[model samples]
Target: MPVLAGAEPFSHTASTEVGVLLCHGFTGSPASMRPWGRYLADLGHTVRCPRLPGHGTTWQECNRTRWTNWYDCVHTEFETLARSCESVFVFGLSMGGTLSLRLAQQLGDAVAGLALVNPSVLTLRKDARLLPVLGRVLPSVKGVGGDIAKPGVIEPAYARTPVRAAASLSRLWKLVREDLYKVTQPMLLMHSVVDHVVEPVNSRVIAEGVRSTQLTEVLLYDSYHVATLDNDAPLIFERSAEFVRSVRQVAA
Candidate 1:
């Protein structure tokens, strides 16, 4: 499957010792995070937004990959940045946020801080439990993409949901939530008042589970699931940058 043009990975290097790793959601590509990555890069920070495995391609292709593959991609990027940058912060959307939390838990102080938007730690829908069984028979289902509330904005995402891959993601969610207390760094969470794909409770779970004393949650009244591309996008960008700076100052 040919990758979408705008969905390619994006990287920028600045002279700063501080770097940021931006992770996009499940079925989403770097296209979903390009604006936010560029905004931070323009501010002179080193940034890397990588296309995850099984993403930016046909839904059939995505079904072949699992959560470990996706996590490996971002984990490698984090390692590369950590070797050079004095401090590295991670920011992610949706499932990407779930991965960021896992990184924070695994690497501890190596991950200076985290900024997440509408992160999912668990599925609120009861049917999601059947994914492990149904995935074997049902290869794909209707996609949950393009849930943005903004008019005329389309997220570059798979048209179908690969049940097997989704089931793999559910496993990752369980592992992340179990060790949430280990992610005790400065944290900033942004969640929409009404999100269609990932429920608002997803954010609440992270807020309540993580032991970060520096946790901050911002409510987005105007945006939906993909707030990074919705009406409050600018606000998400600005506040995230500000949060990164404040965390850096404290570490210094």
Candidate 2:
């Protein structure tokens, strides 16, 4: 499948021993994370942003993939970074955040730290409970993309929500929530105070559930769900870089 413009995965090889893996949200392509990756790379940190399977293409194709496919893609990228760097920090937005948390849980100290933006584990939508059944009859619904508060900034995401893929994501959410206690690494969590796609309670759930002793939470007042590309993006980038440096220094 031909990937969309600006949606291609990106990687930067730096001389530094520290690396950062960036994961974009469900249905969102690497375009959403490209700037952040560039910022880290400019700071001489090895960086990667992989395009999850079923993304960066048609939503119909996305419907054919499962959450495991996305997770596996991220896992491969992390392994690639781990092979070349002494320490690897995982950063994610939305569902990418969920996958990052799972990595920290399953990989343990292999993940030096985590920086999450609007990571989602739960949703309050009453209809979400019926996704398992609805997916059988429905192929898709309205998209949840382009929720950025910054005017004129657009996220390269699917125009429709793939029901089957979304159903698979819900299952992944349950698993991540169950294993939150295993995520013991230091974490930097940032969320939009006025996000329309993911509720603030989602971040609260993670903050309360994670076993990390060092947890920093910042609320984005100017951005929406996709804060990485919104008005508060620079703040997210700066804070994440600082967080990675602090964690890597401690690890050293």
Q: Which candidate number has the best TM-score?
A: 2
> Candidate 1's C-alpha lDDT?
0.92
Per-residue alpha-carbon lDDT of candidate 1 for residues 1-252, written as tens digits (9 for 90 to 100): 688878999999994678999999998889889999989999989999999998998888888999999999999999989877888999999999999998999899899999999999998899999999989999999998888998999998988999999999999999999999898999999999999999888888889999999998999999998889999999999999899889988877
Candidate 2 TM-score over all chains jointly: 0.99
**Deviation (Å) of 59 in candidate 2:** 0.5
- Summarize candidate 2's per-residue lDDT along 94-158 as a digit string, tens digits: 99999999999899999999999999999999999999999999999999998999889999899
**Per-residue error at 74 for model 2, in Å?**
0.5
TM-score of each: 0.98, 0.99
Clashing pairs in 1: none
lDDT of 2 at 4: 98
Candidate 2, pairs of clashing residues: none
What is the C-alpha local distance difference test score of each model? Answer: 0.92, 0.95
